[model samples]
Target: MITSPIWLPATLFAGAVQAWRTALQKRVSQNLSVNAAGLVRYLYGLPFAFLMLGLYQWAFAPSAFPALGRLFPLFCAAGGLAQIIATNLLLMAFNHRNFVVGTAYSKTEAVQGAILSFLLLGETLSALSWVGILCGVAGVMILSTGGKRMEPADFVRALGKPSALCGIASGLFFALTAIGIRRATQEVATPDHIRAALIVLCCTITMQTVMQGVWLFWREREQVSRIFLTWRSSGQVGFLASLGSACWFTGFATAPVALVRIVGQVEVIFTLAFSHFYLREKMRGSEVSGLLLIAMGVILALAGTMR
Candidate 1:
């Protein structure tokens, strides 16, 4: 049996909320431009992120708020900017002819995250954890293929496509974001992991809001008003995005970044549910097998942590 860890539940919650938030964001995108849709999460979520930080500070009453170290801002900025770019790349992939190829390659984040975490932070995972990561990647790849069987040669060729390259790059940047944030949390001068995470979350969100807001004003000025005009939906997306981010940041603070991301593979399960029920799509046999592999990967990763 897998023992309970705060990171496990935190990551799981983050993954579920993220899958839901993405769906809502897509709906908002239909009404707004891609950049505007991307901005909504940070722009509207800014207030809630602050609210969460304030509430946590009040409730916990840490003897002293953690002081941000010199490296804190650097990590936050790097992580924040990486996330923005990664998101844009993922969105760009959706516009490609073979979008699924991009989506599948993007799912390589778990593996990429592991590698980057090791290189950047010297974090190491167990042998089992590595296996779990590979399994999750394979599962995501299968699902991304929409259940189609691709020969080894075809799979290699697909990776050379423009969409595939975008997806691969997206995953790399996302891995960087995770590594940067995790390192940022470690830079705080406090023993309270949650408080450190909240501080980072608030700072990163504020920066992202400002950065994205400027871009919207300069390039997509027309969509600026539409963002607020569709506040009902945009607000919901913002709230969920903030809530999900809180859990993700907490996970990063409390566990190895790679392990947290490995568990986050569960997000695919939520995505599958949305496709089946919300989109009225049928589940393919390959998707079922992929789901099983993802579940197994999560279990193995979690179990490795326990041991």
Candidate 2:
């Protein structure tokens, strides 16, 4: 099998881009629930994803969506649904923890995605890359636990905390989503695979946006005003978030989904750096060390992937 060299770089760049956007989303979450924030970002992104899909279809192939059986759409939809849950959880995570830690929670996707793809989808990595994956996991562990393990009591306590639960749930949701998307896309034995995949992603996101708006309207009617007000205040952040999602989805499509997920672990470092430098937050020594570990892990993982 031929591997694309550019896929690694694309995945890395996507991680950086997504981290920047996640930071923006965290800022927006200061005034919104995870689902409410999802509504904002997806609504912001809906038109753009559609427009991009249309342009891709028009400029290249009008007959892109073809012969996808029922299962393909289901898997694709599952992927989108996973993202919806993940994004909402992410918002909650931001509320529960610092941006860096919340982001570290999401970086757990690397290990989870790898295992899921291997077991559920029969996809495996090279032995070298497996070592890289281990490094990536160790880095994430450092970021999340800071070389310390929670007491079992503390672990149980975190379960009662909505924010912590949300963040961990969101990371798990996204990891499951990545695995599903990989399965669906891999089965694209038809023409215009990328285009069809793009279409599926767009439609799923649109549905997720609508569903979120409805749910938030019913359950958090009082916060609707705040949601809109927050949107106005952080609308640009939403836009940046959409762009980041676009980059991430594109990167996922560009490479083996597992590889993309692994490289995406680098987001923790990027998010912490962004918070320290841009938000003017002081970085703890632990934070700096965590960043170094994550960076080194990613480099090793990428190196193992070299042909």
Candidate 3:
């Protein structure tokens, strides 16, 4: 059992799992509408989420279930809805730009999350952690660009495009989602971060499933049928998404949202590794440098946490 803070390791594990989930979702996206693809994560994952909650309770708190506070619903709704919007916006971005550029723009979530967390939750990071956050962001930018030589002016111009706007908007909503989940977990009257995380995860996933299911039923009933038709792949997405989300929520419960997100930037690195080994893609020098920078940033952040 995690006797101390599990934020750092939890974030790393979540990042790795999320990378695989994203890859699976990308395949799912090919066969489904963006909204339908996004729904798969919640719709298929609902059962697994409940199963996880039951397992947690049986293992850790068999005697009593923690009572949900009044604020729990509000927090869950905010987080669940924000995440759905963010996912849709990200999927829309695929139509506007290439995957690399879209991902780079969306990666601004770390910086935006820091700002939002401070404004909304009054959370502050140490100077070293701030440096880590910046470094991690830089590393992600480098990886996303893949060492392409675009002029500064061209880069600035690209930001004005619709895809960039969608990416930025998605990042903002993602920041809000993280903040809301953290707030929800905090509102739980339990000291067990695992239990709190599980409760919040179950509630959020249930709400998301219902919201997305209703939309699919009315607007895209065919897509709903297609989702079940592709359950084999969709199930993989759901399982990984559910596990990654549980780790992410647990990390949020243990640390400030901004810090948790900064550390979570390691997801880029994991994606790169998958590309290199599975996709057999070669990494460029800039990509290597970016990885090093991300490592340095994560190390600094971990050191800061030790203090």
- Best by the TM-score measure: 1
Task: State how far residue 218 of model 3 sits from its true place (Å).
Answer: 1.6
The residue-by-residue lDDT of candidate 2 on 170-238, one tens digit each, is 778988887766566555655444565566657666766777778888888776777667656466655
Which segments of candidate 3 are over 4 A away from where they belong?
1-4, 98-101
For model 3, what is the C-alpha lDDT against the true structure? 0.86
Q: How many angstroms is residue 128 displaced in model 3 relative to the true structure, after the best TM-score fit?
A: 1.3
Ranking by TM-score: 1, 3, 2
| CA-RMSD of model 1 | 2.3
- The digit string of per-residue lDDT tens for model 3 on 150-238 reads 55566567777878888889889999999999999988888888889989999999999999989988999988889989999999999
lDDT value, residue 243 of candidate 1: 93
lDDT of each: 0.87, 0.67, 0.86
Worst 10 residues of 3 by lDDT: 1-10
- Per-model TM-score, in order, reads 0.95, 0.78, 0.94
Off by over 4 Å in 1: 1-4, 60-62, 274-281
99-175 in candidate 1: lDDT tens per residue? 87888889889998888877877888888988988888888888888878876577578888888899999999999
